[model samples]
Target: MQKFNVTPLLVMLGALGLTACGSSEQEEAPQSTKFSLGVSDAPVTEAAAVVVCFSGIQLVGNDQPPQSFTLGQDSSAADTNDLCRDAAGNVIPNTRGIDLLQLQGAASEALISNAEVAPGNYGQLRLDIAQGSYLQRLDGSRHPVQVPSNQLRLNGPTLSAGGTFSYTLEFDLRKALVDPVGIPGYFVKPTGLRLVDNSEIGHLEGLVAESFLINNQCNVNPADERAAVAAVYIYEGLDLPIAELADNGGTNTHQPYASTAVFFNNDATEYQYAIGYVDAGNYTVAISCDTTDDPENPDEVNFIVTKNITIEARQEPHQLDF
Candidate 1:
């Protein structure tokens, strides 16, 4: 059995307890709602999909001990498995996005900072996909339509201890198959119920270090840009993020050996991405040990720790044999 957990973060999550309580006083213990949904796809025509709807989302937190929620099953996994469907029956990840959710920690009622969520009545939701293509829905006239990731916003948001609500979402494969309806690649299907717990489960499982070098690559826009940038993220080998192994091979840390941002100093706005090397592994190598190289202005180069890594590929999150 391969061993993997959020070993790095365990110390940081020390003695977590419920952060806040709402004024409801429970009058009799606030009631919570559970949403379960069934999702399917249409005959593969032009590549469109539908999204489920959600409403009235509540945050369940407490005072003494911290809590966590599991998905439909007690996987105790992060966004990869803990997805939820709405009472109206739409699927969403049980997290805000790939990176926002985690293994063990306090979940407060306050809005998450830099949380990746569609604005609306959302309590940490996401979408997960296997390997095929997801289409986009275009109109409400249809069951669910396409909505840009950036356009997703909340109308009014308030979360309290032990409060609950309902929500909805739709999906469209057509729009997504076309030019515009593109949800970020990191999006995964949402599950339900954030279980409260402190015991640690595996963080991300799958091929941890998968370095692919694609040559003869096709270009999206050959005119304006010369090359393209790509990335390899860590998860349960699923879409939910575990740790980010930048193209340069950073260990979730932006040191010189690895970096999450494709461009330097742009970590704030610039997406956490990577660029595939010419040989996939070999090319102009960079490690962010110290901000030595100037992104815009060319400067001298140094090998912070350009290690040549080689490994065998098998069903990852590899098993450990005794």
Candidate 2:
């Protein structure tokens, strides 16, 4: 069996506590509301760290002026403000540097807390990315990550008055982060990005039995070691055929909604995998030891285990083991 290393990157932004502000003289002015926003990521292979520095965030909607915010100067979360610090431990003026790999599987870092904005439907949310974003490989080599336009524009959700709303922006790096043919640095595309309401999302986790790995002739690494010899692929609908399951590429008909590597956990003494920020719905989950999945191209892979599962909004994580 050919052991394949699998890694996927996800960016989740949860917004909460949107309360209306007191109005005064300007009846025509839009009512202001408060919301909290945070970011999180899934695991990745081959890279020790993927750091992105966000300079600012902008919200554009309702034909009103764009609401812009600088990272530290705005109402930043105190606890997570240190995440924007530089090598000398001083907070960078307007940028927030986040290590996406450090936050995996239900873990997140707060960016802005109780930030005020106009209450209305927003069509675009722009992330102003700074230069110097880079990826550090396992071998300790660092390469710059180039964002095409220095910003990422994602579809925004509607913010109503007197109600709290949470949303997540998922970035599937497997299909979005790519290396150019002759370019020296890596590139980040907007292809695999998605924005979903957090209130309608749930989590998924499970263990892969040792006997199952052995039966499939997988490389059973030590329990204490971390290796991506296997992986779990998740599709949006249930009972999907194993032959039609696809990678993270765009052209595939059955492209995976999300995927994560299965690695041995020392604490549990079992191989485990966890996928977070999944939209609540029916899904088909498949496990493969011969996981030679290439996000840029469709590849033939053999699945040893397949099952159907349902996820409910705000419910406890669904577990499906092989």
Candidate 3:
């Protein structure tokens, strides 16, 4: 119920060639290869539902300008669901963006299935999103979400002739949504996004006991605890200097890669956090619970701890406790 359909809008765009990828009128028809692109999301804590409505996906390579692919809505696939629809009451595909948060536990919704393209050195992949996408708050309120330029250009994986390439476009909602103070709605920043081979990423899940709080108290304000999780951050390198985290949770710097809010699961009795799609490499996990009252230099007196971990390609997420 979190997603809203914009099928007529998508069909309208496709008719105008606005979603078309290539425009070469005299280009020869080369033997096309197949590339399967899917979309997924890292867990976010700001809202109950993060819905994005995509209309088309375009693949750009060295041999061609770009090739457009239709996103049909099919629910049989693991990534496809009933969250989208067309005028005929059929589930639309890639054309309708999904609640990336809904496709979790390494699940990805297929964006392009067996998309045919000129086999060559593909450099970029572009995704076209509809203008109707919005975020649904926990209290059942909806707010308009902004997309930068209405498209995302990602580094594409190469597709060899007569071969197939598969990749998943992972959206990091924690870092992507900018909730500026005094701003009523959130803005979607695509720069924090990344595309990775489905086999080259790992999931990280961990637990934070209630005693993990700063001086036995949740550092979060009393009014902000209604959501499912508490704030937790992830960085790329080892331990990051306190100066790097000096900002008021601003992720303007490039050091911080992704973040997830830890959920206080009622059944588990612990704060559980999960990073659904992380590239295989070294990473530092940080949790900040203020132990001091200083607001300017909060990082100096917070119950912040960093854990260095190495993730292997396709390895099952191991529990990292604090």
Best candidate, lDDT-wise?
Answer: 2
Quote the lDDT for 143 in model 1.
27
Given candidate 3, what's the lDDT at residue 255? 46
lDDT of 3: 0.65
Give the per-residue lDDT of model 2 (tens digit) for 213-250.
Answer: 98899868753354466878889898887777766653
- Residues 1-322, candidate 1: write the lDDT tens digits: 9986776566445423122233334454544433322122111121123232222122222222212233332332223232223345455544322111111111122112122222223333333222222224323122222233423322223233343322222121111222223534323222111221112111111111112211212112212121122222111121222223232223333322222212111223221222111011211223322222222233332222222232122212222110
Candidate 3 C-alpha lDDT tens digits along 268-303: 556666776778888777775531211112234243
* Native-to-model Cα distance after best TM-score fit, residue 48 in candidate 1, in Å: 11
lDDT for model 1:
0.24
Where in model 3 is the C-alpha error above 4 Å? Answer: 1-32, 73-94, 180-184, 214-216, 219-228, 242-254, 290-303
Q: Which has the better TM-score: candidate 2, or candidate 3?
A: 2
TM-score of 1: 0.20
